[model samples]
Target: IMRWNKNIRLSCAYLFRIKYNGKYLLVKGNRIDQYQPIGGVYKYYASFNELKTKLEIEDEEEINFYEEGDLRQITKGKYLEKFLDWFDTKKNREVTVIRELIEELHIGEISIEQLIKSMQIEYLKTVKEEIKFSKHFQVDELKIFNIYEVRIPDETLAEIINNDKYSLVEAGEINKLCFMKKGLSTKISETSKYII
Candidate 1:
């Protein structure tokens, strides 16, 4: 019999597919070093401190500065199924895309009302990265991402963001493997293609 470790790393994130003119919007990645969709790991509120300890979940090894409390965590493998059930309850952890939308898009100066009126979004699909041993992190990680499509009714944001921080690439070219940078094209992150 093949024996596996009874340890797991669970993570969940919300990603948005913000498209315009037949191209998808991608932001330069800071963590893995390539353009990626706009969204990040879910965060849990401090009120769940008790459950956090019980599950033995901790911050991901990656450096994070966002402040809420990283939901990317480690726990005994035996708790994996149980934890997922709890997550579905939508208790204690973040369940909205608003935080990431505002933060990633640099949406400030405008109230939530403005933000809401400017765009339309709906649930798209869930991309599941089942439990697997990550050689880089040396932990078995299980990740789930809820994707949504954000459609801007006007050019409000497209006109505002005129910087290199964001890049719009054709849908067909997204998986072409590389995005040009500084006149030289380098390989893009594989995760970006999974969204399609």
Candidate 2:
């Protein structure tokens, strides 16, 4: 059985399957030990402007607003629209995925242009009309998880390890680089088999 939260709103996440030498890349955040995919939550509205009239600002000049239940309902459509825009932009997907890889895992050798040229996008699956519950909040998300595979040479992998952007811990110590296949999971707010 699934629990429902009345405060549910839409959210988007990306799951990258960065494969090298047969295994896929898995990352554990600085604060946690459990490894997940190399992705993060995509914030639909970085600022109040993106919300437009959906979110009522008390002060139109300063964009002051109270955080409450009604605000979630009002902004649900904006979140859904942002996710739909992401879904429709195929080329943007490749670029954003590549940028995220570089930012998260420090996979810097591959450029956006090169990835756009050589990357293979496998539309894994979609989870529509699902409500994900957490301790902090609940989200009714149309989550789409896709796998991106790119082959990198040994030297480039070494470069990633030496870079400052690669900061993941493994085995109670800082790991230069590591890849695994079994424990790989998506960056969804809720745990589901669709991610695998």
RMSDs, each prediction?
2.7, 9.0
Q: lDDT values of the candidates?
A: 0.74, 0.41
What are the clashing pairs of model 2? none
Clashing pairs for model 1 are 6-77
Give the Cα error of residue 57 in candidate 1, in Å.
2.4
Quote each prediction's TM-score: 0.86, 0.48
Please, what are the lDDT tens digits per residue for candidate 2 over residues 124-152? 54445444443433333344444444455
lDDT at residue 114 of model 1 (Cα atoms): 73
- Compared with the true structure, model 1 gives a TM-score of 0.86
| Model 2 bad stretches (over 4 Å) | 1-5, 43-52, 55-95, 107-129, 138-146, 158-196
